[model samples]
Target: MFDFVRKHTRLLQFVLVLLIFPSFVFFGIQGYSRFTGGEATAVAKVDGHDITRAEWDAAQRDQVERLRRQMPGLDPKFLDTPEMRLQVLDGLVRERTMLAAADKLHLVTTDDRLQRIFATDPQFAQLRNADGSVSKEFLAAQGMSSVQFAQRLRQELSMRQVLQGITATAVGPAGSSGTALDALLQQREIQLQRFEPKDYLAKVSPSDADIEAYYKNPVHAAEFEAPEQADIEYLVLDLEALKKDIKVPEEDLKKYYTENEARYSTPAERRASHILVKAEKSLPEAERAKAREKAEKLLAEVKKAPGSFAELARKNSDDPGSKERGGDLDFFGRGAMVKPFEDAAFGLKPGEISGVVESDFGFHIIQVTAARGGDKKSYEEVRAGIEDEIRKQLAQRKFSEVAVEFTNTVYEQSDSLKPAADKFKLELRTASAVKRAPQPGATGPLASTKFLDALFGNEAVRNKRNTEAVETGPNQMVSGRIVKHEPARQRALAEVKAQVRDRVAAEQAAALARKVGEARLAELSKAPETALPGATLTISRAQTRDLPREVVDATLRANADKLPAVEGVDLGAQGYAVVRLLKVLPRDPATGDMARLQQQYAQAWADAESQAYFASLKTRLGARTTEAAAAAASSPAAN
Candidate 1:
């Protein structure tokens, strides 16, 4: 993998750039012990402390959100798989393991440090409210509470501190850069003999007897074992179809509108203008004082000549966003601006200038031009929307109750899905053939892994009975009984004789090709400058414009310490190539080249060390998880 990455360095770097930050930029730790209470099940245990299902679900949601935001055009379903879920679970388990060790070591994050991290990280920075407090509404939208967010942040920070020290040791020792630079910057040129498998195919032909002998080998039989599959007849209870019978009362709509009135009301807005003198939050006290003094002078000038405010703002204001429009910030509601700035603007009468105010961005001199909005929507205007929302809500609630009943009926009856189908008024559907996993273009409940697992399980397949109902979609449940079951068994040699013959021939040809290629390579390596009897192309360290990736990988990784060094690789269907290293070209390092190379090497070593550390940590904690835990985490519970 490293050799392939080195061969496609540019592409590798591009991929790495896209993937580097998402692993570390965590968000939404989900539920707190306070929020979940005793409702959450333990998904995994690290050093005896449990990492809850709620936490794992939260982490998976956070990761999915990150992927969606970063790659907007990507199909979200591609990210929804057992593999991706397992990756998220593993990450959560690793983090919990680290936190457990950190607790034993008495490592903790201070309030000040936690606040600083929140202020710095872009993910949490936007959640800061005007009053310099974290916004609960924003946190709630992210599926996190204040306590959960702080705990997650502290856990990450504590682990980061521990990892930082460990990874630092893996970086290069002092004065080692020069030697590394020489090897890294060295280039190589090679003479190559092209040997296509077609050339050997004509030279080596296997007889029918030889093919049969190879086909009958016990080692080859296991590879031909067929995967278990089943044909199932299933009943699907789709909520949307059931929803057609749901009804919403006028009184319910009115009650919903009255309770969620804030959703239909617009907050009051103020059109304000401000002249800002910018200073960094971390600026020295003296520097901050200077900016504030400048702001006061600007405020005094604005007070003296209010008519010239536009000219003064355009010339002196540090706010590039509004300075050109004469400090115009348009109209904004409460919570839009920093608390001090918002307070100063709202407190003033129209056409009145306020005293200098300080905010995180620095000091601001403000004036309110107009106040508008704050309209409460009438029932007549929102009646239709409220009715629709209430109807949908009621339908969803009814569906949940019915779904549970449907699942129970199917499980209890076990003989057939007819009872559940009759109870839910759903039609029994039959799938002709289904694989262990969903095939491309498969749709509906049949495509779901949970449903497939039940369909193929012992009771459903062997006993010819209905399996437990499986939730396949939002407000969707399904249960299936195998119509026909195919047990996993090795295919008969007669049935796959032609396929086996072709494979045996290919294997024999490749072996012969490799044997001949290795002998030629050995002979070529004895001479430093001898040419082989084939096409010779000049190759360079910077690029391999037309070479096959496998060839380039072999060339780059081949030792060039001794000229005419030989490397032979089997290129599958294309046969084998014997590469002869003819020259080793060393170039002088350009300005900062050595430093950059050293940094790259250091990063590689750090990553290796971190991976090793985490592996050891996982082993030490005796961490373990199950598919049952993942299923429990993903399944929705009654609110």
Candidate 2:
């Protein structure tokens, strides 16, 4: 199919031009309206070229949508911060500058490459046709036409070319990476002594006055403040619930089965083996001919002695991926391989060999091995699945009509969800005390932020009415009202007196432990050959399997030029550890490996060079956000 398209390029181009003219006119009108509307406000400038507010909004939305898809249940409030908005705007500016650089470099992408990219992209894989052409339905679903998609693809490829050109020569300097690696891999020997909390508990006892003083302190009072919370009662209307009642008529099922038979059937697939004669696409004509001649000879041999195919492939096949496996490609469906290779293999019957076939990868001598699993399933075999699909469709159609009725029922009778629940036959569920975030043990539509926001808003909380029906998830609407609300206040000290006493005693005990440990270390430092009490272990600088962070850092930073250099680390409630640096040991010669660090070092340099190039490009482009736009980005109310 791709071969046919390429062969008729001239005729196809003429037809495309005729088909695209009206679309261009339609888009021209849209472009004019975009510039005339309120959306045309300029938010930034790149080399005196305006960046409209509409463009910024669209880019920001794209970033948000990408993040949402990558991370489900992500709190939208986290993305609404002023910092996030500015980061999004900066990203847009960077992209624009990159494209401008690409234009300056005159980088271009061919139509053939664009078609291949779109055909292979995973997002459109489901929409691909057997002929390798994407359908109109797919384009419409993506909200783009072929022309628009091609233009975007061209810009993306051009930007990639420019960036690759800029960073291609990024190489780390000599000896620098090795020195960094050596330092990172350095190991030092040290000795440690840990003082347990229980050992000092008996020595440190605080009175009631000490506990009272600690609890009354201003710093401790901040810890006890509570957050505002609410409880809501909600009614849900999920479209999936309607599927149980939807009955697809047998006649309608039969009609659908006939109209969309392909959806229920699998295309024929073939299993094949091939001996590839590898030759570079850009090889000299003589070299290519030599490879093709060799492949043709192999084809003749395979045709004469089919049983020797696997043995010959093992010894002569140039395809490393399958050479050892007798050049087997296993079973592959249509549109999986290059056209020429596929055409040659599929044309042969099982146990038949084909003449040498030429592809971009070079010549291939092929043999069809086996074929299986392309049979159309009987109607009875697929009845259950077809019934489910039909029911889902019916449920969706019913939802479209019922959603309106559900919204009206809730709005008109805002005082209670009883009416809406009864009309929709939904359950009126009550949720216990819930905060802005989802409440513990709470699941279903009521757990969503939108549901909580609507339920807790003044209209629902103050007026004590049902919220407007909110779409919490796909085909699911929830209308909720606050059943109870709690305003945040500082927790009373009397209610927490016991907890405060325990906390105060713990602090005093830790301080006592630290004091005792410090005194012991001081004494140990004075002695020529002193052994500290408590369990001691010799450890390496890079060894921190179970060592506390405070103890590890003190050991690493301690002066070990002299013997028995001591360091005291306060370990809070767990007490303190007195670590003694027993000896200064140089890094082990066997510790560092230069070979392992080269790729990482090279990648770091490449990243740095790319950043520097982009920084310079950004400066040269003279991209600047307007004061008003900057302010808007930093404001919570910014669109």
Candidate 3:
């Protein structure tokens, strides 16, 4: 074969092209694109730049992480929805559009402005130093250098500047704000006759024939079918298992302890009291001088009558937080206060008063009440913790090596997961009836979608072979095989008859209620003075009066220019609602605060203008979002 191919290299090459080119033309490009971060994955475009799938996925993960942090008790699955993911993409598009606009508008944040914002913004308090400087140490802790932090801050400033003009200056048209607020708060006296399905359920008796026919309906098959599932035996190669195998040398642990000795010691703290006078560095020199003189007088009083320091601080201190506590800054560790204040507090011994000291916040007179801590735990006392830490570090480093060996063993052995599990000392875990998607409350490797997907892959299912080691999470790899596969099957009608009967009954009941409600509505239309049979209450968007939201909306939306207007609302499965609007009343004054409403209206007006301006910017900059990248993005901003 080699001799023949060598002698006819050109001919062989031609034959190969003839055999492969068609496949390449049909499948190669598409198969390749799916893996690349180019056109195939672009969710949006801004200035002809593609926002790829990788970026969108990363943004969504970050968004989920942030939301998880903000609301720790909320289910992560709720936040990781298709709608929220698409919305995140929408946000990315809007962000990209703003960046493009800012670039075109030559909007660059000035260094001075950046410094001022970092120094004065309460949001950046954690990143601000004692002298109103950027905290390099804090930035380093966040893995951002000062230069990178400055760049990130500048980008944020620029993005803000793009929309700042419209949002900052927009004003609602005269009476527009009041008109909107009044409409929202407008109350209507309503007589609600709700035909709830539950109330009418007794009226519905679905025949067996009807139930059987409904169950047999093709549209309802999915709800009746048991999803395809499998029994799987999965082996996980993870840091936890590796840690059990790790043997840490005591000398190495001692070395780690010495290097991180600060971790073993309790940080020193000082209890102090101070009287501060408002004297920001940005204040005029004379004003600052006056503040210093005032602080000096307070210091003099403290020195003359040490016991009266707290009394003077309570009366004379401008620091609202501490002043209410008699200027007592309860025990705080180093780096908790400004450099000058900390120095003054720490320099004084117990019951000693310090001279006036200046800081970015103001001039302060300090009185140190007490000092404590600075205790160190011996090596033996913290030995176990240090050894565990060392083991984890070593295991982390060893994970990649073990994962590769584990991968090879799983694939080479192919038929079973036992070899890999035994080799890695991993538990041979078995899960029955595991579906492709993680079940609710699923945990560990079974909860990982990647592992489930690989387990259910065609090759793994058909051949009963182990899946390729899939990375389920950080330092976690899993390979699973199908022990038994169950294809999706329809349940017998007898099996789900009770549920089917109830569903059919509810649906029929709902339909009947709507029909009767509509008939009642027609009679009310003909006879405006017809008395309603159900509850009579005043309702508005602001106060629903315990009525169904549909009834409230129907009542509010009824043509109020003509009194005694009648409307019918179909409430789907809940049933129907008929609202008779007796009269349109003035917006209730007590239901909502007019001042707050006005402020909210003004804010909304500004937001709408900002969004409108952003849309215009998108048009000019050739920024566009793919339909798939947006779900509820078109919802009215103010509403």
Top of the candidates by lDDT = 3
Q: Local distance difference test, per candidate?
A: 0.72, 0.72, 0.78
lDDT of 2 by residue, 342-456 (tens): 8987788898888888999989988899987578877888888888988888888889788899999999999888888777777778766677777666677756777777777
Q: Is 2 or 3 the stronger prediction by lDDT? A: 3
What are the clashing pairs of model 3? Answer: none
> In candidate 1, what are the lDDT values of residues 363-466, reduced to their tens digit?
89888999887799999999987776666677777887787888889889988877777777778888776877888899887668777777777767779888
Question: Candidate 1 — which residues are off by over 4 angstroms?
Answer: 1-123, 138-159, 165-186, 203-205, 239-414, 417-428, 522-550, 557-566, 570-574, 586-597, 608-639
Which of 1 and 2 is the better model by lDDT? 2
User: Which candidate gets the maximum TM-score versus the true structure?
Assistant: 2
Q: Worst 10-residue stretch by lDDT in candidate 1? A: 28-37
